[model samples]
Target chain A: MNDHELDIILKKSLQPDVSVDDTLFNEKEELKNMKPMWIIKPAIALVACAAIVFSVFTFNNNANVTTNNSSQSTDTTNAFALKVKAVGKQVIELKKDVSIASRYGEVGAWGGGENDDNNYETDYYETFPIACEGNNIDKITYSINNGSFQIINVKGDGFVVDGEKVAPLDKGGILPKSCSDRGITNMEDMLAENYEEGYYSSFTVDPDFQESEDVIVNICDNLTVDEETYRKIWCFSVGPYKDKDISKLSKEENIKMLELVKEGMNDVLSNVVINCTVTYRDGTTESKEIGVTKIVVTPEEAKTLEGFKNKKVKVPSLYTAYKAL
Target chain B: MNKVEFEDMIKQYGVDLLRFCRMYLYSKEDGDDLYQDMLLTLWKKRDKIDYDANVKSYALSVAIRIAKNRRRTWSIRSRIAPESSYEQMLDSGTQIKLQDSKAKQSSDPEDIYVNQEQIIMVRNAANELPNKYRAVIYLYYSADLSIKEIASCLKLPENTVKTRLSRGRALLKERLEAMYYE
Candidate 1:
């Protein structure tokens, strides 16, 4: 087609039906729904804090009773507090010397027209570090929304020893084959995997991979855990894993696994609770339950969250952002 | 601007703004959502708007900003959780129906078919362009905005807008020709 012919075609195709009435745009409804963000933020923060405090107190009380019944020698001290810095940008920090942060890297893209450079858009999937104060930690188990607790174990090679402190293999650690095999580098692949499996592999590390008792308790007495150094050592994997092997499961069992995967993926960071079991050199064991309440985010991430809350940014699915992360 | 003036502005330029949104987003549903959001935002910021200035230009600029922000968010979202095949088929069906309705002026079946094919080709070609080029092309042709107006809305120089339009047209021509041959 000539330039003039192309212009005519372009105009015709690009111009939408302007005569159609907008039934969706109701000013009165929109105005009525628009509450000031300043009012909503404080109310939400207060409610969240109250809920966290109540839940933590109840959990700690139950743990104390259990410890008292089981063994009179056990220490039931609340030593840890799990605070979520941000939801979309998942950052879990311990008061002592451990921090776990999930980051989505734009590895690559696929599927674009020959002439379309803009079509190459990055697909995001989460890779996070698994670090903890290994000296006192006997075992750590995490649960989502008061669900059954699942053990958090080291994956890929083994723990990294920094003088007396030990942390799980950081960012360079190998991820589960299931995650790597799917090649989740683009939108098309991600969607295909989501449809077929009903959910992406929620955890970066193999949850079923159990570490030996020796590895779990390998720590030195003189070494102090550096929270800053551990925080910087980002890992490729960390999250709750399924109890059973997927390959060995029956069809019904497979379905249940899918359900669990979907549930874990959907659960927000706010709902996550971590239970840390500490072991002292004197052979005394202590149980501590950490509850997440306050969300501390950087200024940039805060802006994005605010924009999302204000409805300025449209997220297609409720937990799709989690999938991207 | 008061509510009356806001209502008037919507009455005058709402359709164009909605059309701009649809073109930018490439989805009727999302376009409608953006349009409502734009209207709400405009109403919220009505007092701050210069009453004597080009209200349509201001409205279009707001829509553009919203579209850009939403797309940045949606880009990640769409990649992870794209619409299902059934939903996509439904969207395609809607597009065909829209094309058919628009082509009602043509009596001949062959002419309607040709028109529909041509329209889909042109749209697909345009959609493939980068946002910078597509925005300029859509504003110039779809929204009927001048280069000066587009420059003002985008906060880019008039020369930059002109360059984008020219490059956008060239890319569209190349893609359309390839599609025609295929």
Candidate 2:
């Protein structure tokens, strides 16, 4: 059918079934009881950092020692110094953990969503303590811009970054398939293009580059496809457009253009990968250069596109955008 | 927030939250657990939430984060019993109920049959979508949230949300045509 009919069917099918029982909120009884105490907990975690650290470490280690037991002594005079040392060590460890967590959190959780994979930060920290076990930490510092992290784990080379032993950047095999697939272009080829002119930029792991090893992924600059090419396909597929310069268009005009693009592109945009090269660790690469004419649109989408073209929408062919690009 | 206010807030947003959980998580059982956990989180942070802030949006944001974290932990569970398709995720009883609901709305026998089948087909297709696309579609269509509201809730650009909705609808349209024509 037409767009209107399609919209009707979708809206009708997706309507919420509001038959939920009122008693659903009754289960909130237990939650309500814990409210005030739970509300104050993050503040507590921030203030009583040492205690929280102690409890967390103790719980994870399954250690039987309490804060009292760790410092209790028959010599009252020495107990004060021993307690001070223990607190100092605990503070050091807490700083190290938090530093590691924050550094990796920025890397791993940066621009990530619920559907996105591999919290690099959480994964790094999960195995951090165990990996660096039996080492005494004197300092833990990291650079924000560069992923270079330094953790003083005395056993030596607990993990290595750039051939030096460090904690944060040493965890291995955290690459996503999108970044790891072979037959793509070489790292340099991916980085050769000026991306500011393009619609989007992507970051992926480049194992072949020996600069950073184990946990880090490299950004490929040349691998980016210009947004105009995709936007053209998207715009044409949504409806029709003139060869008007995108730069000359007003903000409202651009929005209208995007709205049409949305209508035409439908959901097939994710699958619309152009021929690109992927570099392997061995320095060899392959190209998956499927043309835009071969863009994977379903029969229904194709039919709908044709219908729009036949009508006043005057949608252009998907290949027209590809050919122009 | 007072107990009465909390209850009122829940009453207002519970259906939307439950529906979101169901759509996001393939299993009803997992959805139920996530729904409870989300409410617990909102309750804990109730005092911190401003009175003028949009509670529904805030609750949705919390629910999404909780679900994402839980999914990460339960990744193995998903792998072990992969509900790859919505048809597989839906129980026979639920399917029957959906069919009956459609049937009650239509007097013509053929229309009833077609409508039921179409519903099942659409639901399965919707389930197959990538999480991002499915989420946008559910919020827009089922929850009746605007594109702006959805973008705000998911912390995405409005254009991104619009693109996803377009892509999601394309998939749904593809499936509907396949079932109807072929």
Candidate 3:
């Protein structure tokens, strides 16, 4: 078709029919009558800010009360930070070094009680075996190749010779030494510029905030109430979720509540009133709120303790089993 | 803008916006729905828009943006359910009309009949154009937007818009000729 003919036809086809019904008129009218964003935007932001502040205040206030109650009680020893590593004493019985033949002597198969006409009895040993080892006292001792001696009192019942009750295996004595182990041996190795390494914890920003960067993870260790113990917590700093973005969520309030829950758990883990302070690469420090629940040390946590008594001791291969001295 | 002013703006530019959308999109229903959505968007963003600026151009730009976004969403949806997208576009019997009219033709037909068929073919051909070319064509011809204005609206280089327009015209001509001869 020529340009003139095409143009005329296009105009004719493109134009809406004058008689066409406006089915969408009501919808359009509703939209037109809708409040302008200038008013709604700030209103929504204010509501969101009020919501966040209210939530943070209420949540932190409740958390502070819980912390104070837990701390004031004279039983701080039982009060583990939510899920701190709990290591307890386990007493494993030492197995006796006795052989089957020594215990049973000679077994006679199909032997009669007193006498049998055609006896199927067979004697394995010419004489009955006596007790193999001497009836010694309840003291167990081991000398490496008959050199230096190591003694463990069998009847001591997990008590040291001084009569002090000691845990069979104590984790408190085993301090953390590696970053992953919750100990920062070297600050240089533990601090990461990007999300690649430093502990990546998660924290929600102000409901009205927008994040330019991703959430950064940092590993933080604070000395616990027990001077010897360092409470290890992961600090996560996430970019803000803007009000508009939050509004896009199906349940913005629910998400905000979830963020509050995260904050609550982080508060319990870090034991901080607000955000925990984190040191950056350039020695500049910033406070980043904790985002995730603290890591709990299970009873099955690998034993990190090295020596028993100035001597390198090999722990038993099995978790609950004990290695005899 | 007050409610009356907003309603008036919609009545004035709504038809032109719908035309741009219809020529730009494959489905008239999709275009119609998109037109309503564009009006809603304009109403919401009315505060940000400068009253001194050209309202028609702004509406055209908004229409184009909405069309682009809808196409993007459709493309993603089509990948997930290709048959559903095809059914949606062709469910209105436009494809059937195009197919039926393809073989039956006359060396010469009545003026009204020829005009009617040409209009259908033109709409179909414009719809069949690639999204980039279709967008440029609609803005240039239907919206009467300058090449520079189209580039600004689509956030593309002026030279890119010009190239697309030339390619789009050539393609549209080919589609029309194919309908006529074949």
Candidate 4:
């Protein structure tokens, strides 16, 4: 085809009446539009933030293939600016009775349930099935092993006797921690940055307004408001989702994914209802000014949280659940 | 520099942009829809725009980018639309063949002999060309852009732009000669 011929033909193909100005840019709306922020822990202390619209985290053992429930990581990296870490107390009880080959009726050194290697590093702990009998309470003495030692009473009722009650564990529960628990030993040394390391007794994002770079986790305490229940609350922000990206969700997608995650978290939170609000640029607000609603967390997640499973803890009150947006 | 400049910019480039729009997107409705959207985006981004930069270039760039994106969307929609009606036979049907016989029917009575048949044959031949060549030819004639300008607007290298134009021209020449020159 000659250039001129092609030009004339192409030109005519474009009907003169056709208007060309109506292009829409929906690039801002991506598939992972409404999801919570999550991280894939690579190692201890090297905690890094990864952002993905949709991602899967899985592990397998032998022929048992399991597809993990997928989740979206939507947290703003800048929101977790405060780098802090916390060391929570966890009492790992090996449910099965462990023992040695029964050498000489002497119950030779080989039989025990506890891993002694871990004993040297506990923030606070005690040995059991030992030589001491009757008292259940053995003579308490301590060593800091790698770090310093501070005695803490693990009440038989399961509360950490640290001047006040924290989230209590059952007969055997790993000590709970959050981004707020890194203040026990030395707030100065522990709080070197956001996501610090150590135990903290409480949380209330100090200087909260300064766009927190800190994410503190405590191994020995519970952030769940009421100390009576002994249940821990883990709170993290997916995003400041107040702007256009989330608002763009066509009332349907936002709601669908929100229901999914809320369902997933239900097992852990037990009837935890998420209250949500959206603030638009027009000075208009979509708030619980919308209304309060219940979200049934998933059954699998409910199993992970002892509190969620218990007949006791009050139903969770969270306004941050994804809306039908 | 505010609404007036934006409105003025639209008025000046609006017709040319409309011509550019018609080349790829078939429907008049779709083209105008895109044109409005482009104007709004220009107005929205007005403050960030380099006031000294060529508004025509910027608007054309935005239009092309938007057009490509819209084409992707339309392709998806087209695939999903009813298999028959959405394929745009209005442009491809025998009307264009009939149009092939009628020359530019200008009322000037100047007897310039602008055979509408020649124009229709030319249009069909161009439309039948590969999308790349069709686009280059569209930009060259309909958009009145230089090779370098087309390259910058489409984010292609100048050589590629020239190549597309030359190749597109060659194809059109071959097709038109085969169909009409005979």
Top model by lDDT, which number? 1
Off by over 4 Å in 1: A32-325, B76-114
Local accuracy of candidate 2 as per-residue lDDT tens digits, B86-120: 44434422322345555546654334322546665
Residue range with the least summed lDDT across 10 consecutive positions in model 2 chain B: B89-98
Chain A TM-score of each candidate structure, as shown: 0.24, 0.19, 0.15, 0.18
DockQ score, prediction 4: 0.07
Which ten contiguous residues of candidate 2 chain A have the minimum total lDDT? A37-46
Enumerate the candidates' DockQ scores in order: 0.19, 0.10, 0.06, 0.07
lDDT, candidate 4, A1-325, per-residue tens: 3344445455454334323233332323321231111211111000001111112111111121121111122332211111101001111111111111100111100000111121111111111110101111211111111211111221232221222223332111111122224322222222333322222222111111111213211122111222211111111112122122533544444444344333322333232222222222233333221111224323344345322333221222112111111
Residue-wise lDDT of candidate 1 within B7-76, one digit each (tens)?
Answer: 7787777778877877676666666767787888888798898867888777888888766544533432
TM-score of chain B of each: 0.79, 0.77, 0.69, 0.73
Ranking by DockQ: 1, 2, 4, 3
Query: Tens digit of lDDT per residue, candidate 1, span A46-162?
Result: 111211111100000010101111122244442433232223333334343222221211110111011123332211122222232323333333322332221122333332211
lDDT of each: 0.43, 0.39, 0.36, 0.35
lDDT of 2 at B63: 74
- lDDT, candidate 3, at A24: 38
| True lDDT of residue B69, candidate 1 | 41
